[model samples]
Target chain A: MAVIHTDDSGDPRLDDFRHLSTADRRPDRPGGKGLVIAEGTVVVSRLLASRYPVRALLGVERRFAELAGELAGTDVPQYVTSAETMADVVGFHLNRGILAVADRPAPLTVDDVVTGAGTIAVLEGVGDHENLGALFRNAAALGVGGVLLGPGCSDPLYRRSVRVSMGHVLRVPFGDLTDWPGGLDDLRARGFAVAAFTPRPGSVPLRELREHAPGPVALLFGAEGPGLTESALAAADHAVRIPMPAGVDSLNIATAAAVAFYELASGG
Target chain B: MAVIHTDDSGDPRLDDFRHLSTADRRPDRPGGKGLVIAEGTVVVSRLLASRYPVRALLGVERRFAELAGELAGTDVPQYVTSAETMADVVGFHLNRGILAVADRPAPLTVDDVVTGAGTIAVLEGVGDHENLGALFRNAAALGVGGVLLGPGCSDPLYRRSVRVSMGHVLRVPFGDLTDWPGGLDDLRARGFAVAAFTPRPGSVPLRELREHAPGPVALLFGAEGPGLTESALAAADHAVRIPMPAGVDSLNIATAAAVAFYELASGG
Candidate 1:
């Protein structure tokens, strides 16, 4: 690994780290190279270890020194600069003091995520980056094997999502399901029981989920408000609810996912 | 109820809602009124329904009309203004379209919150307002009866906490415990088993929490990074953990709380 020191904020090698806030938005669009970004030492280390190809790292001297162990194995460019130049290049004061950018690997398949997995999370309309990231973090913690994004989900590889997931987005395998509710059949084909989480009436209590699906389980979650679409719920093998007190609003999407993940993990 | 037409941004009558961003911080300090503020119609309605004394409301005409049923029983002054004027008063562009201010009632005691409760959440060093608020929301959703704040916890009534909690903070009962770990004894005397949540080794899995405490349970939590202080953990009757894959980070404080809340609620 090369430790390149420079005080110039306009260095071309730092272009990948420039204007990060705007650059992260719609990276798939023209003029937007949707590079996977990991912030801080923990996330940076995760990025270095993950399958995603690490492009380079930009940080202050102390942060680079702190990550020396992780850098031992990688040959990625390490740009060391003062905090002022780092902030100028990134278009914001990054308190994390360190960042690692990686190009997205070849997209994972639905099979790639769900293969050899007993428990997985399926999401719909969960467009909030923080919520999506948090779900990955919870899924990782609870031992959920993978995540399958159905529709209207945000990019889990987005910088905000990566940061919020504490870098678990890189660790948790995820893939887009282009067929919408139709794709749920594939999960069922793979012997996964699809359970849609909803507060709608007549849904089975989540506690009984293990009894309902003793084999592989796929817990489906919708956005906080305007929960799972009628089609999504109808398509699931079972509609489950956490059984909250009447008159209380539904839990946040990610928090709800965490609850369901814990229940399924514990029961299994 | 009197519907006052107010276009004046500087109206003294609307002072409670002025410069809300800064006004919400350290309300107990000099030049700070420490009023409980609720933003958005949902939270405003909750503030109206809570035990706190409703001071006044400021909102656009549309939001007022939407909350007509909730407004019917109250004689409090309702100041109607355009969105621009409302924004000017609050010093931000609040899309919530409604706001309510309330005076804190006499504080509830630990005994008061835990008296009839089968499940309650005790928090320590949870100084983040959003996390504090989300924990209350989860507590309400999972049927945890109340919340007790230990040292280093943020004020649940803070404006941001109130909003993030979706107004559940107003619904859930909470009180400060000035005695640190010593106050935990009061809960035990009241027939509550105080279980401190931590990822420390040798701690019992959270799934067996019900087995360990069949009766009432108080799930104690700490902040995100630094978990429960050693003294707090040692003082508790039990130390519980949600088993996770090795090398993964701990769950977010509130997300962990929700998972624990679900586990206990499911077993009960």
Candidate 2:
């Protein structure tokens, strides 16, 4: 375990954790894919166990003690500081007493993630980071094999998402679909049925999704309000909907996805 | 429909809409029996359509115009004011240009909500107001009969819960389950099967819940981390679990409830 006790917040070793509030870390942003940050002991432990390259960790001494088991065999700098100083450096106190930053790992190809997967989630227009995170967490819990990001989706590794996912964003395999509706063809080619979720008339109920598209299903969803576009809906093999009472608005995208994922998860 | 325009934030008529951040209206708080509040045009429309006695509404002129249809035949005062004044009175900018407050209706007994309910949700230790509200929203959408709040549950009428529920909390029937574990016996006596959701071993997979319990069901859930208590689990006719991947944590309480509700919802 590499532990360095330091009371100073300005030390350059904490550079990756600085100005995180201004996390314009998108690929198009100036810094180019800012460090993937995991907050608190549970998430930090997940990050340390992930494939991403951990640069350093910053936290109060007590949190470090909680994380000591995960720190074994690691050579990364573990900077220990007081809560106030750590808050000053991270720009927030709710970082939950521990923060670990990691360099983004090599992107997994859609095929790499889809191979041998029984159930996968494919998303489009899911721009909200927290929804994205919650979706991943549900996916992980429900045993969805992989996630394929479609158009208009935000980066799942954004700090808020990582925390919300409870670091499952680091554990669950995900990759960009890149081809839009055309890319859905690849899923079909791999013997997977593409089931798009929508509330349109003639759509089958969620429970019947398995009957419409048998094994190895790819559950497709879109952002809540706009929902699945015509192109995406047409590309799918089946249109599934969670039966809602008349007059109620459609379920939130993430919650809708959880229901679908729960239905298709093996042994459920 | 009654519409009254006023620019003054201090108008005595706008008292229900005043200092909402303080939320001094909670019955247990300094203020007695706080009015149930609904924000945003969608939730506001729901409020107008709900059974709760609408006392008054405060919003920008445009929002009132948008809600003209739902407001029809309601003699309750509809106070129109500038967005700036609305912000000041509400103590927040994100009221979505509208707010509605209704007197807390007479408390419904457990039988009132459970009557003719084919499926119901029973919550234990669900103290988070947002989770409580979201559960109601899911129940409303998924066609669950009603919510019976077990011990340790919070008042779903809290401001954040109302917004999170998109005001479905106002529409769905809910009541306190004063009997605790004994209440499970009541549900069973009413020809309803009580199924508790847990991650505990030996619990049947959720999909089997319909087969095991069949017809009417009362799904029981606990707080997120410490799930349903031992007594509650023993009280249930069957213990059901969502299938999860090895090493993954359980789903969020509300999301888990939604998945369970979706499973038991008829014709879904």
TM-score of each: 0.97, 0.96
Tens-place lDDT digits, model 1, residues A150-261: 8898889988899899999999999998898999998999999999998888989988888899999989988988899999988999999889898897888888888888
Give the per-residue lDDT digits (tens) of candidate 1, residues B66-87.
Answer: 8999999789999999999999
The candidate 2 chain A region of ten consecutive residues with least summed lDDT is: A22-31
User: What's the residue-level lDDT of A81 in candidate 2?
Assistant: 90
Worst 10 residues of 2 chain B by lDDT: B24-33
TM-score of 2: 0.96
Candidate 2, position A34, lDDT: 73
Candidate 1 docking: what grade?
high
Q: Comparing to the true complex, what docking class would candidate 2 get?
A: high
Q: Please tell me which predicted candidate would have the highest TM-score against the true structure.
A: 1
lDDT of 2 by residue, A1-268 (tens): 6788887878887877877786646565344777788889999999988999999999999999998888978899999899988987878775489889888877999878999899999999999999999999999998888999999999999988998899999998999999989999989999999999889989997777767777799999999899989999999999988889898988878788888887777432
